[model samples]
Target: MFEKILIANRGEIACRIIRTAKQLGIATVAVYSDADANSQHVKQADEAIYIGESPASQSYLQMDRIIQAALDTGAQAIHPGYGFLSENDQFALACEKNNIVFIGPPVAAILAMGLKATSKALMEKAGVPLTPGYHGTNQDADFLKQQADGIGYPVLIKASAGGGGKGMRLVERGADFLGALSSCKNEAKSSFGNDEVLVERYVMNPRHIEVQVFGDSHGNYVHLFERDCSVQRRHQKVLEEAPAPQMAEAKLEVMRQAAIDAARAVNYVGAGTVEFIVEQDGTSYFMEMNTRLQVEHPVTEMITGQDLVEWQLRVAFGEPLPKLQHELHIHGHAIEARVYAEEPEKGYLPAIGKISYLHYPEQNQNVRVDSGIVDGDEITTYYDPMIAKLIVWGKNREAALVQMHHALGHFHVEGLGNNIAFLDRIIRCDSFKHARLDTNLIQREDEFLFKNIQKANAQLIISAAFTALLSLFKQNITANNPVWQAESLWRLNISNSYPIKFKLDDENILVNFSPVEHGFIAEYQGQNYQVSGTLIDQNSIHIEIDGKKDKLAFSQNETALTLFSNAQNFKFAYIRPDFNTDDSDSNDHNLKAPMPGVITKVLVSANDHVKKDDVLLTLEAMKIEYSIRAPQDGIIAAAYFQVGDQVKAGDELVEFQVLAEDVA
Candidate 1:
């Protein structure tokens, strides 16, 4: 094996590679952009090198820079961890030219399967079952539309060179074909620098299944069984599991053979995934091939008891297959949940902010966490917002899900939009627990998930009160004040009530309280309550209200506090008595940016009248497009920004003027 290998990616995957490399007694080097200077991956690697700017094009995708860095650091090989330059055929060829081993498939394999159209044709020729679609090279819009028309409505417009659902659209009618095509093309061009698309018949109620295949230079090949990635949102997987539930052994064998054939067809080596779209009836059709390690590979690892990264390195070094196809067998069931820093209530708009507190479930033999972040890390708009991946294992699917639900309860985050609560709900939902999964899991379970942000429940309100009182008590102790030492201060009277107002979402709660024997007597929402608290830390506390105890988490700013408990996050602002006396209405006409992002398009300009629900602007953050619409019919007084402008959260994008007659 080579002495040193440089990782050509950043974030969790890079860190993941580094971990395996270290166990193999191999030295690893990490390359980072300015944004990831202090990243956990950088700290974990044996040595680190500075790359280019934050944007991938200038840094992670800068093939020349990455190659030169590897060479300059005396590294013998480069591992392209999944995303950046992993599937770039040119990069593989470049590595071959430089005499540095590329720990991935060959250039020929990448080229053969790089584009969807070419890959589809090759798969068809290779006798792999394929979906009915148009994978032609004809780029004319009319020609594609005609193909879509012939294929029937509800066809899928997929970017020829897309993954992670970046450039995909489902058109349900001929009237929406052109618009869908336009949107798909734009997103494709922006994401992959390829606007070409393929039209295919959309599979209704489909489950995504992918087989893990590996190969060596000696022409030996084996399969690591399969993973079902059916639970998805926006065509991207949210959770994945190994040895798909309800999948028969006979069908799995057939798919495994087909996957091996697909790999042998391309002469693929190292780690790769052969994806299939399986109908409800168990008929599977080839979707596409991913030529590198998958994000959900941990589920396969936990079930198969195999280290895929180690396999990749061994094969890259010309080693034979570690185990024959017959020798590999699935063990316990495993599931992986991708925890992202994106909001669910706000249409999953990517949230960019400092992660004030970050903690994952405690790791054990059954539960594992693979992450690239720590507390105080910032979730910026320059990169994907995935915080970590939670993987759990059990003897059966039901037990695995039970473990997953328990693990999610321990997963915590603050000061950003996250999907932890959503994950929790999915794991515990009756449908999900029964394994009724598909690509529409989010849509099907939307009712029970993300229930209108979080209202100020009694638990949260009491937790907040405890936290505030604790601070005051600590301050008095530090100052040697005797006020808190007196039991009379515990009982609030006409002269002792200290009114504190807090804003929760759009509603406000006022509480007046004083110290009491064994607890505190607090009045909130026109009721008095007994509350007790134990300080866990400056940022965490255990509180009890009326005999109900809750271990809650909280963080505070100058005028606000964010409290998290029981899978819910409540934002509260400390309404100071001196700050603002204005009970006037807020500026509802101004459409503010929900998060920090660049304005991709400004649909309306100054004085443009817009109807309610009209698309006024669009924001692109964390590689997702969010449309900002007008809440009600209004006249635009002025446009605050134009296309390609960068804005922060709460920055108004448009100012509206309401005429008296129209308002009346």
Candidate 2:
């Protein structure tokens, strides 16, 4: 085994690899960018090296700097965890030339499967099942439109070198093909530097099931079963699980054998995944192969009792396969939810800030969390927005689902918006519980699934009110004196009726509180309640209200106060009584950057009259393009930013002239 291995990545996957390497008595080296200087992964590694600046192109994607760091540290092998240079063929070849082992598949296999169109053609030739579409090298707009016409409407135009849904577009009609194709090509060129694309039939209600395959240099290989990655938004997976629920035994065997065959056909080595799109009828088609450890690999690890990182290390050392095809066994069901720093209600835009407060639930036999962030870490805009991954395991699928729901509720993160509430809603959906999932699940049921979770539970409101009252009393006691007696104040205001109204969601609640033993007694709608608890800190209170015990944590800063309970975080504040109290001069009619990004194009010019929804400009961030639209029907009074300018979130890009009719 190698004495030291360099991890050429950051975030949760970097931390995950270091953990297994430590368990195996191996020292680990971590590489980080400027943004990740104080990251959790950097602190956990035995040795750390500074790579480059915050931008990935300057840091994580710099192959030479990474290889030099490995050489400087005397690392025998380099492990590319998931993204960045993980699947770069040239990086693997560079390691081979430098006599440093790459803990992944060989360069040839990576090159073979890296291009989507090329891989699809290769699979077809090798007798692997493929979707019926155009994989030819035709790039002309008219030619592609003809192909789409032949394939029928609702076709998918995918980048030949794309992954993670970048450079992809779905066209519902032939008339819209040209514009969508142009958008896809532009995105592909910017994201992957490859503009080649392929058109295919968009499979409706198709479940994304991928089989994990591992191989050795000696041409030995085996499959580690499958993971269902159907819960997605914008073609990116948000949740995943191993041993797909409601999957027939016979179909599973077929997928397993096909995955093994796909690996053998390419002479694949190290850890790789063969992805497939399975329809409702149980028929599956080959998608593409990922020639590196996946972001969702933990689900497979939990179900199979195998450390994929360990396997990568062993395979790089030229070891033979540890087990044969028949030796592998799936023991239990496991699910993983990717917690991202994005707001689902706000179109999942990336959120960035310092993590003021972070609380992770305790790990047990069934629940596991993999994260590379902490309370004080800064979530910058330079990298992927995934904050952490929550994984849970159980003896059965239903049990695993239940445990996953509970785990998501316990995860508390503040100072930035997240998709925790969105994840909780997904797991509780009837269609999801019945395993009726598909790639379009998020788009199909987004309105119902992404609704505000804080407003759903009535019990939570009472709990928050009780906890809030306790906090007020605790603050009074603490402010008065350190050793002040609560008994003396208990008798003074026992019957002083004071009405306090609070808003939970859309509803308002009126309650009366009076001093009581230990805490306060709350009365609402003729219900007598004894709420008692000592405040732990500014953020949390332990109390029993109306014979129901609850632990509530409240975080109040200048802007908002979020209450954590029932495994979900709820934001509450004193709703200002007056609506027009703020300074009117601060209400500027200007278009601002939603997030830090490079302006790709400016669709409007100064003095141009525009209507609401008119495109003003487009910005690219983290490989996703977002168009900034006009807020109202107005003239573009001034354009502050131009194409190719880098702008930060809230930085003004354009000024809109308010019309007299609109001023009212």
Candidate maximizing lDDT: 1
Clashes of each: 2, 3
Candidate 1 lDDT, tens digit per residue, 1-664?
8789999998889989999999999999999999999999999999999999988878999989989999999999999988879999999999999999999999999988889999999989889999998999997888999999999988999999999989999999998999999999999998888999999999998999999999889998889999999998888899999989887788888788889999999998999999999987788999999999999999999999999999999999999989998799889899999999987777777878899878778899899999998999998988989999999999999889889988887787887889988888887776678888778877887777755444667657767866776765653221233334622444444466556678777676877765555566778777788777667777778777888877777777777777776666677888766777686877877789888888988889887888888898899888888899887778888888988898998998888876566689
Please, what's the RMSD in Å of model 1?
3.3
Q: What overall lDDT, based on C-alpha atoms, would model 1 receive against the true structure? A: 0.86
Across 132-176, the per-residue lDDT of candidate 2 in tens digits comes to 899988788899999999999899999999999889999998889
TM-score of 1: 0.92
Each prediction's TM-score against the native?
0.92, 0.93
Clashing pairs in 2: 409-567, 410-567, 539-554
Worst 10 residues of 1 by lDDT: 475-484
C-alpha lDDT (0 to 100) for residue 292 of candidate 2:
92
Query: Candidate 2 — worst ten consecutive residues by lDDT sum?
Result: 475-484
